[model samples]
Structure formats: structure tokens, C-alpha cells
Target: MHPETHLALHHTRATDLRAEAAAHRLAAQARRPYAIRTRLGWTLVEVGLRLASPRPAFAH
Candidate 1:
């Protein structure tokens, strides 16, 4: 009886783990990174800022 109960608990836990993993996979696919798009805008802004800012000290 105790062994059967333990197996039942283990089965429930495995199902819970599978559900959690499925949820994570769904979330990952639904909200993916737009690296090229994001990076393009950011890189342009950064370049503009650097061009507009003063240069650091340097010896001749």
C-alpha cells in the first residue's frame, strides 16, 4: 500500500513537471527576441550619441 501511494505521488509530480515544461515552451515561442530589429535601432542611437559627444583626452 505504501509503495503504491509513493508511485502515485511520483506520477502526479511527473505530470506537473511536464505541464510546467510545456508552459515554458509555449511562452518562449510566443515571446521571442527580435535581436536584429532591436539591435539596429539601439546601435543607431548609440552611434549618434557617440558622434554627438565630446572625445576623450589623448596625447598628440
Candidate 2:
């Protein structure tokens, strides 16, 4: 293949790959709120469990 043609092909492939990666990144960003909510729910559950548990008394 000619050098110019190879370079063009490489540029097209790189652009396509970049577009694909950008789409994936946007998808992840869209789901970020759900991920944060899930983490917050778990953290709240942990806090609730800690509050419900009994503590040991120290000897005087």
C-alpha cells in the first residue's frame, strides 16, 4: 500500500476508535448517579447496623 493511503486509513481508524471510547465514557457518566446512590444506600445500611449493635462496657 502507498504511504499516503496507509496514513489516511490509520487516521480514520483512530477517529472511529476515539468516537467509540467517547460513547462508552458518556454511557458510564449517565450511570454515575445510580452508582453513587447504590454506594450511599450501602453506607446508610452500615451506619444503621452500627447504631443497632451493642457496645461492651469497660471495667472500672
TM-scores for all predictions: 0.57, 0.73
Runs in model 2 lying further than 4 Å from the true structure = 52-54
Estimate candidate 1's RMSD in Å: 2.9
Per-residue C-alpha lDDT of model 1 across residues 1-60, encoded as one tens digit per residue: 699999999999999999999999998777666666788989999999999999999999
Off by over 4 Å in 1: 33-37, 56-60
Clashing pairs in 2: none
lDDT agreement with native, every candidate: 0.92, 0.97
Across 4-59, the per-residue lDDT of candidate 2 in tens digits comes to: 99999999999999999999999999889899899999999999999999998999
| Model 2 vs. true fold: TM | 0.73
Model 1, position 54, has a per-residue lDDT of 100
TM-score of the candidate numbered 1? 0.57
Residue pairs in collision within model 1: none
